[model samples]
Every structure is written in structure tokens, then in C-alpha cells.
Target: MTERPVTQFGPDFPFAHDDWIRHPSGLGAIPTDSHGASVAVIGAGLSGLVAAYELMKLGLRPILFESGQLGGRLRSQPFEGADDVVAELGGMRFPVSGTGFYHYADLLGLETKPFPNPLTEAAGSTVIDLEGETFYAKSLGDLPSVFQEVAKAYDEALESGANYSALKQAIRTRDKARIKEIWNPIVQAWDERTFYDFVTSSPAFQRLSFRHREVFGQVGFGTGGWDSDFPNSMLEILRVNVTECDDRQRFFVGGVERLPQGLWRRAPDRMVHWPKGTSLQSLNGGALRPGASAIRRLPDGKVAVRDRWGREDVFDAVIATCQSWLLTTAIDTEESLFSQKLWMALDRTRYMQSSKTFVMVDRPFWKDVDPRTGRDAMSMTLTDRLTRGTYLFDNGPDRPGVICLTYSWMSDALKMLPLPVERRVELALSALEKIYPGLDIAGHVLGDPITVSWEDDPNFLGAFKGALPGHYRYNHRMYGHFMQENLPPSERGIFLAGDDISWTPAWAEGAVQTALNAVWGVMTHLGGRSHADNPGPGDAYPEWGPVALPD
Candidate 1:
């Protein structure tokens, strides 16, 4: 028998969202009366666009509201005077395990290439600098024995602490019962514990020195340093590993922004109640409406969404796809729209800080090899310094190259948040110069640098959600709210979707999955039902939903 490949089947929900979206029978059918119903989708990000697109396919009209850039955090800022050359300031890497997200990417027929992650073949060479020491390697085998020991200890920790192999096997085979059997207990045990707690308490790490722990954080098992996430929930880290969200990563060719923008302009080959040439762009009259400033439920049971300009429109349903905090901060959402418990969940949901600095260069000079040393001019770098992780993008020999000088999180991100873009580049260059002495990186730079601090923007206070210890119930409340059967009539029409509303918060797959959930929620709310052969998340939610804990 062929072994089933692993995708983002939830340890929490365990629904095959990838399978659900790709079903030949279609998502669902709306009632004839609700065919042209107006559904307000707030925010023009991945989640909002996806919900809008799917709802349009189901024969409903989706009105999108945008306050900032259309792509939201999937921004790909192009350098001046450069053709198709871009800096992926946010959400650059996509792992193969994220089948739910790739379903849409594939639908758009976007081209992708393997990302240049450290220690991977795509990077060609990786440079590891820690505690003022430098080491270069082509693979993990070339690193020192300490790295091997750290890697092995992490593996053992997973096996001894989390039943790594069996649990992953369950996920790969799509065994919902077995997955919940193994996962629910771990959630109970680790929900209140931090990632650092899991590492220090584990027998494997206890056998090793604290230096091993530091090395493990500075140069993590996959990608790069994960010390920033050490303060997050152990459940969060475990989700990233078990689901392979950090493995076999790839990036969209032109830019990741293409996915959402393409979906916006794309006209589905088959759609109901609309003309052959209809599209979200055409439906909205070639542009998105202004940002939503307020949401209020009408006496007639319909919802009124008011734009920043004070123009109000009534809709049968509204899907809030913006950052959960925006509900309290940016949007004047009615208190009666959600229960106090859910509002607590939404209000308390924590978001992490992230910053990226990128510069376009004259060419991919880093790929050039020096005659004296058998090494390339520069390699993909990981360090414990302020720069954190530096990535290189080679468009082609004849085209301009792009370099992400620093991709930092939390404190590291905060350090760069106040600095100007020029200073950010100078500091990154200063850090790298020490690692590669005499390397003139400044000489190869060209055009102006582009940087982003997600928290600095009013639209998005942070890059993505980072659930803390003891937040599982909060996550459950927000994620399961789409199945609104028992909710009072007052709150039934308003729904939520986004990465923040998902179990795996930092991943685009989470955004895609939750968006599909809102589609299911909106359809069912309007007296529609999924095809019997192709049940939606809400259909299987009752039997395979996330486990709930005591209040």
C-alpha cells in the first residue's frame, strides 16, 4: 500500500480542508433567494480575498473593504527601476505540507521555486555564526559535533515527550481518531507550559549542557534560530514541526503577493448566478471599497457595515477577516455581535512582532567564488547577532538580485522598528562584515532599501498571532465559532476568519483553512448546504473538532 503524504490535517480539527476545497462536486449551493445576497468581507488580505472568492463561486456577491495595501502581509515591494525584481517583506516561504494554501496557488497556476533555506540544497552553502564564531557548511554533516548532538537531542525530546513518530504517522495517514487520542492529552499536558519549559524539562535536553539549548535556539533544527518563539506555547512549536510547516519550503516566483492579487483578478471557469466574465474585480467595479469603520446589527436582523467614509451598506452576513485585535481597536464593532467570552478571546489574542529589511543589488555577486578560498563570496547566513537571518534571492545571471538583510522577530524586530531603513541596512551590513571579514557587501548594493515593521502599521498591529500558554480554549472558541448552530440569533450573522483565528497561526495554510470555514459558515447561515459527497469543515466539525477544556 502507498503511504499517504502528510498535509495540514489538524491535530486540533483534523479535517482535510485541502480535500474539501478540491472536491469535484463544488463547495455548496445557496438557496435561490440568497443567490445574489450581499456578504461583506472586511480586509483585502489572503483570508478576506479567499472568503470573497469562494463566496462569489457559491453565487453570492462579496463586497471587500480594504484600509491598506491589497495583499496585506503578503506584500512584495518591488525596487525602483527594476523589472519584476521584488523584496518579499512578509510571508515568503511556503511549505509543501500546506496543501490547503497550495490548492489556491495551483488554481492560479503561479510558478514557484525552492526557497534558499539554511542547510538546504537550494541555499548551496550556509554560514552559521554564533557567539563570535563562524562556521560554513554545505549540509548538516559538515557542521560540528555539537550541532549533531543538538539535533539528535531535539529528536529524542520529541520522541520521549510527544510520541513523535506515532503521532506524525497518524497525521500522515489522516487518522482523526488516533490523532485526537494522542494529541488531546498532549494539549492538556502542555497547554499551560511554554516552549522553553518543554525543552528544559525534557530528559534529552537535561542530559546535555545549557550551551546545547542555546545552540538549538540559535541554529534551530529547521530554517534558523527559533529563540524568539521560545516564549510561545509548546503546542505552537509542536504544530510547526509535526505538520512540516517549516520543511521543504518554497516561494512564489515573481512574489507571494501574486497569489492573492491573482485570485482577485481571476474569473473562475465555473460559477453560478453570474455571467461568464464575472470576477471579484469586475464585481467590485475594479477596486475594493474603503476600510470598514463600524459594524452594527440592524433591527431587521441584517448587518450594516460602514466604511471609513461613513457610507453604510446592509448585508445578509459579514465575515471579519482582519486581525482579531482590529475588532477592538480599528473597527467599531457592536458589543452584541459576539458574546463576552468570545470577545475576551478576540481581545486577548496575542500577536507577535516581525520586521524585514531587503535591498536589491546590481547582480547575484554572492554566488561568485573567490580564487584563494574555495568558498562563494557570501552564503545564506544565520547568526545570534541583531541581524538574525539574512536571505539571498537570485533572479537570474542577467537580472538584478534581491537580498533580505535581516529577518528578525520579537525583541530583534523591536530593535529595528524605530530605526530608519538606511540605518537598518547599515546595522545589518555591520553585523555581517564581522562574520565575513573584508567582504565589501556595501559595494554590491543598489537602489533604495525596503523594510517593514508590521506592528508599526495601524491596520495590522503585528505580523501574526503567537498563542501563549493557557490560550488553547481561546483558540477553540474563535476557531469553532464558525459552526454557529447554538449561538443566539443576534451573533449568527457575523463570522471571523484569518490566520489569527487558526490553530497554526503563522502559516498561510491556516488563513486559507479558516477562510474556507467562513465560506461554509456563510453558506449554511443563508440556508445552503454542502454537497453530500463533499462535506465542509462544519459537517465533520461535530465528530472531529478540537477538544475543549474546563472553564
Candidate 2:
């Protein structure tokens, strides 16, 4: 048999959500009496939307509540005059390993192309600038020997510190037992460690100079610099690497926001009890309710959610897909709904900062090669400067192109948090000028610059969850909340689903997987059961759930 490709099945919970959703048996069935039962879905983000969409197909009425726009982080903002040219302000690059997310994309028939990440053929060329030195390369081999050394050392460290090859092979083949056997112990061993700790302490890295480590951080192997995530958990980084979350990435042709929008408007052909023409959009009256301001468990055992306009609605089940921190800061959530330990996990979830500044150019001017150097005017850039990572998007010669002047995270992101879009573009151009001297980057610009500082957005709080050292217990609490049979009755109906609630936070696949978990939870709560042939995440979860660590 051919080996299955690596997917985000689980370093934590090895459930095949993609297959479950694709099953012809169709994600279980609810009783006729429970059909059309109301469920509240907070935040119309990817997770919330996925939960709502699946729930709708399961014959549940999902009332979507959103304080922000339809697509939460999959925001694709269009330039004023450019036809269909968009600046993806959030969740731009998606990896092919994200089969769960792509399942929906395929359902919607959205087109995708390789994202122009540094050193990939999609990028055409890559420029790395670090500590006042700049080097151009089309591939890793073309860079300095030090870069090759750094890449080799990191690979060696992965093999040395973790059973990298065997573990990845198990994940690829979907060997549930072997996956748990290898990954569970690693979780226990490294749950207390940070990514920085892993890198600094690894014998392979220790053998190299600190400069090598710095280079590795500045120009990370797959995407770009990961120094921003240096303080994050080693487990988090390992999950990304093993799952190939940062490799072989692609972006939606029009924009990723089309995904959630497509889901909202799509009428699934295989819906359970709903009419053939019904969709989440049609069910919710073509618009979502206002953002939920407060949530309380009523005396009658059902949950009541009050919208921003003081409209209180009751639901048999509620799924909260907002950032976990919003439970404390924005929403007035009842204290008794979750155990104090679970509340602690929600409150302690740390989110990373991120900023992106984009400008629409008249054409793909960056593709123009200079006769003197025989190099494109500029290339996908990774630098130590505030710009951090700059990506170029070419939209055929006739159409306008987009330039993400800078995509920075952590401290680098925070620097641009206070700046206006124009100022942000100016700062990015200044940084780029240092790399592409005498190039007319400013002259190619058309339309107003677009930018976003996710951390500054109250709705998001931060870009995505970045687990810190010793946060495994917290992650376990959030990720496994959907499997709540053993929990007290008061906490049973409220399910949590988001990338943050998933082991691999920041990846869309996490959101998709967790959403499926919530769908299973809600289905079961509503007196539904999966078909014997095709078990849902909840059915498979007991034996294949995340390994519990002693608190």
C-alpha cells in the first residue's frame, strides 16, 4: 500500500476529521424531535463558521453572532480601485497538509496557487538580509555555506532531540498507536521546555556558534524568521515542523476570506433535515446577529446569550469560537459555566502579536529584471530590519499586483502597532530601500496602502495563540473541552472550538479540526450518534484522545 501523506492528524489527538466529514454516512443524525433545534454560534470566524456550517447540515439551526466582519482572521481587504486585487490582512498562506481546510475549499471550488514564500520557486528569487549583510538566492544551495550549516544543524537537532524521522513516518502513515507512543512521551518530556531552550541546549546547535543559531532564527527553514516564536513552547514548534505546516503553502487565488464567505452562502447538497435550497445564510436571514455581549446559564438548564443590542436568545447548545481571552475581556461570561481550572487555562492562553502592511502596485514591477545585474528589481525579502519579511504578489501583467511590504511578528509587529498605514508603508519602503538601493519601489505604487496590527484589534486580542513553556496542561484543557461527557452537567453544553483551542494554534487546520470536534460534541448532546462505519471525532476520541498529563 502507498504511504499516506503527512497531515495534521495529531501530535495531540489522532482523529481523522477530514475523512469523517467526507464520509457518505454524513456525520451522524439527530432525532426528528431534535431537528431544527437552535444552537448559538459566536464569532463568524473560520472555526465558528465551520461549526455552524456542519451543525446546519446536521439539521440544527445555527444563529451566528459576530461583532466584527464575516471572516474573522481570514480577512481579505480589497484595494479601492484595483479590480479583485486584495491585500490579505489575515490567514494568507495555507499549507497543503491542511486537508481539513482544503476539503471546504474544494467544496467551494476556490482556486489556489503557491504562496510566494522565500526561496521557493513561487517566490522566483529570495533575498536574505541579516546584520548588515544581504545575499540573494533562488534556492538554499545558492546561499552562503553558513546558511546550509544552520539548516543541517537544525535537522540534525530534530533527529537527535526528538525521534524526528520515525515520528514523522508514523504521522504520515496514520499509525495511531505508534503516533501516541512516540508523541505522548515527547509531550511529557518537552512540555516544560521552550523553543529557545530546545535550540540552545541541543548538542547539534551547541556545537555551532551562536551566530549560526541567530541565522537560523532570522532565516528559518520553511517560511521566514521564527525568532518571534523563540519564547514559545518546543512542542508547538515540533508540531508545526512534523506536520509540515509551514511547507508547501498555497494561497487562495482571489482571497482566503472567500472560504468562510463561501461556507456561509453554500447550501450543502447532503444536508439532513433542511430543505435543498437552505444555507447558513438563508437560515440566518442573510446576515448574522450582532456580537454576543454576555452569556449565562439559565435556571432551566439552557444557555442564554445576549447580543450587543440587548436581544437575549436561548440555545440548547452554544459554541464559543472567539479568542479564549475574549471570554474575560469582551464577553460577560458566567463564572460557573466552566471549572476554575478550565477558566485558568482560558485566561492563561497567550497570543502572539503580528502586523502586515500592504500596497497595491500598478503591475508586477518587481518582476522586471535589471540589465546590469540580471536580477529582478526586488525579491521576496527576509531581513533583520523592522520589515522582517516582505512578499510580492503578481496578478498577471494586465491586472494590479499587491506587495506585502512587511509581515512581522512579536516585537517587530509591536513597533508598527502605533503607526498609521501611510507611515507603516513609509517605514517598510525605507527598509526595502536598504536592500534594493536605487530601485523605484515607491513609484510603482498605486491606490492607498493597507495595513493591520492584529494585536491592536480588540476582537482578535492578538494574532494567534503561541504556547509558552509549561502550558501543555492549559492546551490540553482547551483542546479537549469538546469531549465533555465526564464534565459536570453545567459545563456540558458549551463547546470551545478555535485554532487556539487546538494543539497546533495559528494554523487553519487546527480551527477546522476543533470545529469538527465541536460539531461532534453538539451532535451527541442533541441526541445524535455517528454511523457505525464512519465514527466522528467524539466517537474516536476516547481511545485516541490526547494523553492526559497529571495536573
Candidate 3:
């Protein structure tokens, strides 16, 4: 057996064991006294997988169900001609802000590479076209001539309530003139002639609203809000929190998926292995059975799930790590307060429609010119381009630079895009050349760009989940509100475990933190009074979380 790498955040790491004791819920003892039955984790995404793995450490057994491949969105593809030029489609490039995830990776022996931040693969000679004129704003001194005007406008725009239009539409309108007076100020902010002005209000801010002039208006920048925007000062704070004080911009030497792979590796044998590529036909009401424990309840009774081959099994309990859309379409129809409330909560929230484009080529196709020291090599692009995403890394010296392009596209185009595997690849490749000009496409286009537009998948329905301006602060959870309360007082059999439930949604870090919470709950429940008021564990390397969500 390979010697386990000296873990930076292992159990023996300083204050490791103490962290488990400090959680509000206790470090769980196995549930030998309570029920002594097995627990099942639904979905093999990062959270579900980690929770099951952690439970087994306390001597409780867990089963994981994955309708698709494990790793949720840690997607990878093998390039034919390039030497080890693998491409990642989704969930690539975790920042220094991934605090707990960093700890998890260190323990798993995964090596993280401090890759610089650039908006795309084309490093040098990159241009931002606006008003038919282009500018290259790579360095600090390269600020565009109109940067100051943009700065003031951007400040007003940000300070404005974020969704001023939506908030304006929902305000109390008892008085007509009063309503108009209230709205006039907000209208001036949102309709500064166009959303374009609102975004480009700042020179450094154009990309925040996806106003890059390279492509037509149909395309845009990374679709997420500025709350988690790259290059923001927020990342500096996040890096301090997620990583040790020494860490900075990094991409896992192998790939971003290695972070999850690392966390998965730290898990015991019981968790490292699971049933993969198995389809879940239906889940019966595990929670509603006669005298059944609370954890096992399904919506109506308990979910009775059938496999793709139509084999059926209704377990005593289930751990659902599903995204919002999955519950609406794939779940079996029984009925229960939990399921009804859960679906309703999801129904109330709005999710962004996304289209992801991953372009993997044969070699270091783009010319890299470093401006810091007048060198001709830099593996990052932070441009404000339409139809572009963050991250361009040296996939390997063999392939040079295998670029992964991600864009948050409109979800309504689920029909505008192709459904079949072959068609999907063709569409992605065509989209790639359209964004990057003068790149020899004759044979340079290796295979095809892999597109993962989650809006259509019956299993996930959409990407993990999204949070609007005030959504993060207003409500702890946009979709999973009911489950938050369903956890028993001091003892919860059913715990909400997933990346979507935490602050850093849609990443392995959030998922792992949720797992740590579940393990804490389980240990507390099994130990009875022995483990009371204990501060639970963290994502293995140990980032922090609120014991309870804000009301």
C-alpha cells in the first residue's frame, strides 16, 4: 500500500481532534443504540459521497446512489493527440477561497498548483472591442482613458439594491404619485438608457455585466453575480479564509477535479468505492413507514426507488443531495410535508440558465507574452469578452495549453442547442472558432468542444443552484428551507447535505462542509448525552461554518 501523504489537515494535524469536539452537534458515535440500521446517501456528488464516507468512520455503514457518474460536475475528457491533455468541462479552478476544500485536498495528497488568473486561453494580444474600438487592459497602468467615469457609475450601480428593478416592481404602491416618486430614483439607476451603461459604468467593471464587445450581444461574460466574481477584492479575503495565509491563485497540478478526488481519497475503503452508473427509478417514502424513524421518511411515506433496470428497493432512510430541478422531474410522486415543502421552496427561488463551453486543443496554440517582466508567456486571461469564461492553464507541457472556456448562457435555449452527443460536440466546436479569431481551424480543432448545458439533464435538471443579490443574506437557503427545520432538536436523522446548501455553492468545498455537518449530527444522535454541545468537525482540512443558518 502506498504510504499516506503527510496530511496538512489530518486527524493528527494540530487541533484536528478538538475541532470535532467543538461542534454544536457532537462527534457522532455509531448509532448502535438508536436504530443500528444502515443509512443510504442518494447521489454520488461531492457532498453525498463525503457524508457517507464520514459516517462509516464512526462504524455506521452507508450506501451511495448515483444516476450518473460520481464527482457531480468534476468532468474530465481525454484528448486523442495531445500528451495527457485532458479537459475539464465543469467545476474547474477552485480559488484560494476554497478554505475547507484546500484542507481536504492536502490530506488526500493532491498537489495544488498556484496558477495565475486570466479570463481566457488567449493570453497576449487579447483585445476588448467596445464601440468598434479595442483596448488591452492587462496591467495596472493600462487602465482605459475613461476609467474614472466608469468607477463612479459602477459605485452607484452596486450600492443600488442590486435588483432595483425587481425590488421597485414589488414595493408597496398605495399612492400613485408616491409610487412614481419612489420608482423614479430606481429607474434612473437601472435604465441608465441600457443595462450596458450600468455594467460598463466602470472600466474594470465591464466584464461584471458581460458587456465584452468581441462577440455579438447573444454572448456574454461569466453569468454569475459580482458577489463571487473573479478578480474582485473578495477573493483576497476568501483566500485568507480558505487556504493557509501563504496560498494564492491556484489550479490543482493535475486538474481542479483533483480537489474532490483528494477528498474522496481521504475517505475510508467503505466510501472510496460505490455503485456507479446506476439509475434510480424511484424512491419510496422511507420517512413515513409505520414506527419508522424520522430520517427515513420519504415525501408521502418513504421513497421507493427503482433502478434503471426496474429493480426496486425501499430503504429505511435516504440522503437526497439533489439540485432543485431534479426533485421536480425525477422524484417519484408520493406525498409528505417534507417533500411538499421542499419542492415549494425550490419553486419559489429563481435559478440562472447556463450554457458551458469547454475547448481543448492539441498544443500551446495562443502566443503567451508576459508583460510583468517583458516575457512572452502567461497562462491566464481575465478579459471582459462575450461568450468567454475564466481559466486557461498549461494542461501539460505535452499539450502546452488546453483551454477550458465556460460561459453562463441563457437556459431557455435548451431547445436551441443539440440533444444528441454528436450534435453537442459539433455545436461547441462551431461556437469556439466564432469567439477566437484567426486560429487555424482547418485541423487545429482537435475534436469538438464539450457542452454541458445542465438545463436539460433529467437527473440534475440544471446546474447546482444560484443566489441573487440579496438572496444570500436575506435567506440562508433559497431552495432547501424546509429541511433546515426538519432536523430534529439536537438529533437529526435526515440532514441536508450538498454544495448548494453552503455559502460556496456549486463546489466540492460546500458539499464537503455539509457532509461534515451530517457526520456531526449522526455522531451526536448516536452518542446521546455523551456528545452534547460539541462543535462539529469541518471540511477535513477545516474551514468554518455557522452552527445554524441565519433566520
What would the TM-scores of all predictions be? 0.99, 0.99, 0.64
Clashes, model 3 = 45
lDDT, ranked from best to worst: 1, 2, 3
The candidate, 1 or 2, that scores higher on lDDT is: 1
**Selected candidate, larger lDDT, 2 vs 3:** 2
Give the CA lDDT, 0 to 100, for residue 6 in model 3.
20
User: Between which residue pairs do clashes occur in model 1?
Assistant: none
Q: Candidate 3, which ten residues in sequence have the lowest lDDT sum?
A: 279-288
The residue-by-residue lDDT of candidate 2 on 1-551, one tens digit each, is: 78688998897888888899998888889898999999999999999999999999989999999999999999999999766799999999999999999999999999999999999999999999998899999999999999999999999989988899999999898999999999999999999899989999999899999999899889888999879989999999999999999899999888999999999999988887899989999999989999999999998889999999999999999999999999999999999999999999999999999999999998999899988899988999999999999999998999989999999999999999888888999999998998999998999899899999999998998999999999999999888888888998888899999999999998999999999999999999988989899999888888998888998
Q: Which model is ahead, 1 or 3, in terms of lDDT? A: 1
RMSD of 1: 0.8
lDDT of 1: 0.93
Candidate 3 per-residue C-alpha lDDT over 111-212 given as tens digits, one digit per residue, 9 for 90 to 100: 766544432322332334334454454532354644433444444444443433332232212222433343334433332133444344534465444433
lDDT of 1 by residue, 418-442 (tens): 9999999999999999998888888
